[model samples]
Target chain A: AQTVTQSQPEMSVQEAETVTLSCTYDTSESDYYLFWYKQPPSRQMILVIRQEAYKQQNATENRFSVNFQKAAKSFSLKISDSQLGDAAMYFCAYKIPGNQFYFGTGTSLTVIP
Target chain B: DAGVTQSPTHLIKTRGQQVTLRCSPKSGHDTVSWYQQALGQGPQFIFQYYEEEERQRGNFPDRFSGHQFPNYSSELNVNALLLGDSALYLCASSLLEGRNSPLHFGNGTRLTVT
Candidate 1:
């Protein structure tokens, strides 16, 4: 079984500032996928970004990016120019082949004005 | 394009009662997945269905079952509900085996098992 861990339970960042959420995972599979999802107060889950294990280059999407260190089994999300809308619960997920998903406990992010 | 959708935005059930939740996949998506999100927790994968068959399932018990229709819409059935079964159930859709095909999610069905 694969398990994802988010050591930080909560985080805060001033608006327009930057923040990073840490994530670690345990897996024996050689190929897999990692993702970061955000759930706002409305309770809707939204995909923030994703990374493929086979790729060496980290994935970046505008204000969001990931530092994926496969050998260390770490995948962390970085949010730049954080906005109030970025305040939410952030999740780190693991997906091995066969399409099964494992999620971390999550980190609650708060963007302060 | 319309995104994934789930019905019964909210539901209330008692112990031993049965409940059915529905989902419609995003247009052009053939695979649908279900997840259970307990309050203050991340979503846990419940199962995945494709082409009217269950392709994979998570650690959930047999009481949690699902079915996929030809149109790629899906249903999640839970029997003998327990307090532990209370959650916000989410439905996600993706293209089968497409590299980097991320799953888009619905708002979710909030089930409160009393």
Candidate 2:
């Protein structure tokens, strides 16, 4: 079985500043995928960024990027130039070759003005 | 595109009662998966439907079942609902290709079992 862990329950960042959310996972599969998802007040879960375990280079999407350390089993999300709209609950997920998707407890992000 | 859409954004049921939640997949999507998100917890996979058959499931019991239509729409059915079953039910759509495909989610239906 695979599991994802988000140590931080809540985080806050000043507008225009940068913030990093930490996540870790345990999996036996050598080939897998990692993902970061955001859920706003509207309740829609949106994909933020994704990383392939085989890729040594981390994944970046506009302001959102990840620091993936495969050996350490760590995948963190960094939000640069944070805005008020970035305030939401962020979830870290893991998926293997199978369709089962495992998710962390989630971290609530607050962007302060 | 209209992403994924779920019907009855909110629902209330009692113990021993049954509930059915509907989900319409995003345009061009052929696979649908269902998840249960309890308050303050991440969503947990319930099952995945492809080609109108249950291709995968999680640790949930037989009480939880699902059906996928030819149009790629899906329904999650829970029987003998318990108070513990109260949570937000999410429907996600994606291509059946492989893990490379990301899931597009719908604003979940908040289920309350009283």
Candidate 3:
């Protein structure tokens, strides 16, 4: 069985600042994947970024990026130059060797002006 | 191009009654998966459909059933709905069941079992 954990239930960041959301997971497989999903107030789940276990390079998509530490079993999402639109519930997810996705409890982010 | 699309943005049903939600996979996608997101929790996988067959399932009860059409569309039916069943039902589409595939989600249907 695989499990994902997002320690912070809530987070806040000032506009144009950087914020990091922490996440950890427990999995038996060596080869897997990690992801960060953003769900805004509209309740639409959007993929922010993804990382593969084999790749040491972190995934970056504009202001959204992930610091994936395979040995530590930690995958954290960093939002740089945060804007009001970045305020949403962010979920950290884990995909096993296969594509079975497991999500964390989620972190609700608030971008303050 | 159309992403994963689901029907009935919102629905309300009484207890013990049944409800059905529909979903159409993204263009060129062959796999459809269902997920249930409760209040203050992450989305949990209900099941996955590939080639019109159920390939995998979660820990949900038998009361939750689904059907995938040949056209790659799908429907999720929940029998004897309970208040706990109320949540945002999300439909996702992936190319194949592997690490390389990423799921594209729909807006989700907010089902309220009152």
Among the candidates, what TM-score does chain A have in each? Answer: 0.98, 0.98, 0.97
What are the C-alpha RMSDs, in order, of all predicted structures?
1.1, 0.8, 0.9
TM-score of model 3, chain A?
Answer: 0.97
What is candidate 1's lDDT per residue for B1-114, written digit by digit as tens? 898888999999999999999999999999999999888888888999999999988889999999999999999999999999999999999888786688889999999999
Sort the predicted structures by DockQ, highest score first. 2, 3, 1
Q: Which stretches of candidate 2 lie over 4 Å from their true place?
A: none
Model 3 agreement with the true structure over A8-108: per-residue lDDT tens digits:
99999999999999999998898888889999999889999999899999999999988888889999999999999999999999886556799999999
Return the TM-score for candidate 3, rounded to 2 decimals: 0.98
lDDT of 1 at A59: 96
lDDT of 3 at B12: 96
State every prediction's TM-score relative to the real structure.
0.96, 0.98, 0.98
The DockQ assigned to candidate 1 is 0.71
**Model 2, range B31-75, lDDT digits (tens) per residue?**
999999999999999999999999999989999999999999999
DockQ list for all candidates: 0.71, 0.84, 0.74
The second chain of candidate 1 has a TM-score of 0.98
Q: What overall lDDT, based on C-alpha atoms, would model 2 receive against the true structure?
A: 0.95
Give the candidate number with the greatest lDDT.
Answer: 2
- The all-Cα superposition gives candidate 3 an RMSD in Å to the true structure of 0.9
Please tell me which model should have the higher TM-score, number 1 or number 2.
2
Candidate 2 chain B lowest-lDDT run of ten: B94-103
B1-114 per-residue lDDT for model 3 (tens digits): 988889999999999999999999999999999999999999999999998899999999999999999999999999999999999999999888454688899999999988
